[model samples]
Target chain A: MHLSFSSVIEILGIMAFTVSGAFSAMQKRLDVFGVLILGFVTAIGGGTLRDVLIGNTPVSWLRDVNTPLIILGTTIVTIAFKSSVKNLKVTLLVFDALGLGLFTIIGIQKGMAANFNPGICIALGTITGCFGGVLRDMLLNHIPVLFHKELYAVPCIAGGICYILLRAVVEPQIAEGASVVVISAFRILAVRYNWRLPRV
Target chain B: MHLSFSSVIEILGIMAFTVSGAFSAMQKRLDVFGVLILGFVTAIGGGTLRDVLIGNTPVSWLRDVNTPLIILGTTIVTIAFKSSVKNLKVTLLVFDALGLGLFTIIGIQKGMAANFNPGICIALGTITGCFGGVLRDMLLNHIPVLFHKELYAVPCIAGGICYILLRAVVEPQIAEGASVVVISAFRILAVRYNWRLPRV
Candidate 1:
């Protein structure tokens, strides 16, 4: 199958998110089935939610068999390498940030394609970037970290605004790449500095 | 606005689920905004999921503004009557059972309209019947009661199978109504007798 540049980025995001989810479930001491479910949900949950909310049906993951296969493969590999990979928290954070950035842009593009307003598009992008982790946390019976901590969704929202602005002056492809970089960089920096939102 | 007989049952289901959600959130001491969100999710979450899964765009709730308004109204009334309603656990369970039955039938009908096979339709019906409560429990940081205690989804699945069988011998309308009654009665009886599934 021929792979477009965007499809390649989406695949990378899926793999990264699956790894993040597998590690998280393992950390929680979930069984093999639980780990697999978490991996699949973390890889596709955000995109599924976005499609569902926007009336895009059969959802992206269900339409393409490759997505599930990729997640399954990732989960198995992660499990096999679990002991060696247990010490790489920083690496996990990096993968999570990359997935967050790529998914945010993908969500924005889908929203724009559907002619949603700019504000709504940004919200969709944020939801796409963050909801997978949200679902993972929820399933583990924890209040989602998104609701309380870190600079999680803010970068996606900011990057979405940046993408909209960049579209007026640059090529769409360039804007998309730039937005991904912006979000990923911001997320990494936020983690490095222990940035957090204050309580209401 | 004229209500068909089916629509009337649908409205009752919506109201029952909303009240169930509102009470659950209130018991947890969530703020008013949280209460409203829980109520809304409980009322429409299952149907929204079913619509999205079947490629039905602009989901039923979004197409009808009255649904959200009704949930909002129900939440407010529930909060206002909280003192008097606190002792009505049995009433709440009855409402929940009614909602489970009605939603199961509605989901089965939609799946049949889409020409899905019997098993997939039965699965869809169970999702519609139980996912709202599942979501509510998840958001509250609880392992979904559906996953553990009570004969929750069994009644929906059994009722769905019965609906399919009844279609062979009974009028379609009668089959629909009969399925709802079967599910509700089964659920109420299960709770009264403290029926439960064995641990895996």
Candidate 2:
């Protein structure tokens, strides 16, 4: 089967999230199995959640063999490069932003395909973009960064609304591409400016 | 619709879990909305997880109006009796155990209805029983009690297996009722005796 543009972005997002999870596990001194588990969960967690909420079962990962293989490959690469990977912080953040943007659009599209309300679609998009990190942070026993960190979910929701608005006039691919760019740029700028949500 | 025996237990479980979530939020000094959100998540989190994993969608709460109402009522009661609720530690634990036992069976049955493998069924049962509290603890920024506490998942899994075994020889209702008794007893005893799994 020919891989679509979104499919490539999805794989890239999975790899980025996997690296983030693996790094988190290493920082916490988790065992090898824990590292792999964390990596897998982080990469697919948000999508699994979105699928489940929408009643899609066995999840997307179980359906596609390639996703797991990619996660495994990413995990091995992360472990192999553990010493040098620390120096690639900027690259990692960029990949993470890419993953967030791509996953957000994917989630919104899935929700839209299911004919959910726009509000539910936006919520699904935010959950898709942000919950993987939230789950990763939670498993590591810390507060989820999405709850109070630099604007993450906000960008996802904004981008999702933009996608919905743009889809009416633009081709689906164009709307998706625009949303991805908007989300990634918003996240990158927010982090650069050290923006944070007000703590309750 | 007429409520089944398991349905009553399920509602009770939802209320108990909601109370636990509300208390955790109060301890964290979260505002009213936070408290309500935590309560709702804790009460529905596990089953929502199980359903999603097995392809059940919109989740049980969204299907049944009663579950959300129970959670809402429980949250209000928890807030109203905050001063007195703290003193009811034993009561809370008992209710939590009741919820755990009931939710486990409900989860198992749902998995069985979906025709999952026995191993997956048991896992679904345990997740259903335990994940709400895990989510609750995570939201409160604590390590999941299921991972390190006094034998939580063990009982759920063991009870789930028993449920499967008993179903072969007894009526389904009998098997479910037996499993609930076994799980709740095991949890109560473990807590009373301070039983814990060995750390890896």
Candidate 3:
């Protein structure tokens, strides 16, 4: 497939997640192979789940070798800057938010392309944006952080829905751009302002 | 599927894994929900992956309500005996070994039933036996114990090969029984004797 600007951003976002995932594993003092596994999952886990659920063959990472390089580069960068990142957790948060929104829109777009129902498309987009982290945590034996009343999944879903609604009113390209911005903006505002859903 | 003796043993093995997984979560000071997730992954994760790779819809736990119950029961028992088991790592090893062996054989059987190639079947069995632990550690942002150049994947392959070879010589029913026994026995003995592959 020909690469677009948005696709480049999306791939870069995957790289960022893979780096963080690798860093997370390193925080646990995992070995090199273990770090690679964490990186691999974080990079492709959500998208793989989305594709599998949609019955798409040859998972996304398998389709493109560049995906692994992105993951590898991210992992290397993460390890190199580990100590520096300790004081920059807030920066990390912002970056993660951007990736989250970007990935969510891309996920929804992928789902729509696959011709799934609106509900499932929204769900897949959310899964694609968020479930990679969930899978990473689940693999690490922690209850997924998302289920703990966080604003994570919400923004992804909101972005996906925004994309669908935006598409109904706007051109496809415009809708995609708007959806990414909406989700990313929501994440940024939520973090800065301490927005959260009501907990039972 | 009708419950056979093999099925009964498989459930028992899963119960053991669930107990230990929940116990590990408890040691980490996880809440009730977290413990359940750990137990669920420890017990059913291997088989669940096997089912998914084989294109089994809804996965095994979704197909079998009793599976969750067994995990729940095991979790309750594990939590009840948390203090005792916390100090008894060796006992946990025993159960983990047993579960590991049983899960491997079951995974290989399922793969064969799906008519996957033998090489893929063995790979699937090892993956089924071990990926859960890899996932567990990844979630915790830690290194997976399995990828530490240990006897982990090797033993699973060994056991799976045993099943395939034994089937060539024995009747179907006896072969199934023998396969499970051989795998479990090797697992137990390996742990007891500290048997492991040589370092490169």
Question: Candidate 2 or 3, higher DockQ?
Answer: 2
lDDT of 3 by residue, A2-77 (tens): 9987876677677668877877677666655556667777777888788788776445554355677677777766
Higher-ranked by TM-score: 2 or 3: 2
Q: Which RMSD values do the candidates have, in order?
A: 6.7, 6.5, 7.6
Candidate 1 vs candidate 2: the DockQ winner is: 2
DockQ each: 0.18, 0.23, 0.11
Model 1, A141-172: lDDT tens per residue? 77666655657877998899999999999999
Poorest stretch of ten by lDDT in candidate 1 chain B: B57-66
The deviation in Å at residue A191 for candidate 1 is 16
Displacement of residue A29 (Cα, Å) in model 1 is 12
Task: Point to the candidate with the largest lDDT.
Answer: 1
Residue B43 local lDDT, model 2: 89
Off by over 4 Å in 2: A1-3, B1-23, B26-40, B46-55, B60-134, B141-200
Task: Compute the DockQ of candidate 3.
Answer: 0.11
Put down candidate 3 lDDT per residue, B31-50, tens digits, no spaces.
Answer: 99899898888777777766
Instruction: Provide i-RMS per model in Å.
Output: 5.2, 4.3, 6.3
Instruction: Please estimate how well model 2 matches the true structure, expressed as its whole-model Cα lDDT.
Output: 0.83
Per-model CA lDDT versus the true structure:
0.84, 0.83, 0.74
> Native contacts retained per candidate?
0.32, 0.40, 0.12
Which of 2 and 3 is ahead in lDDT?
2
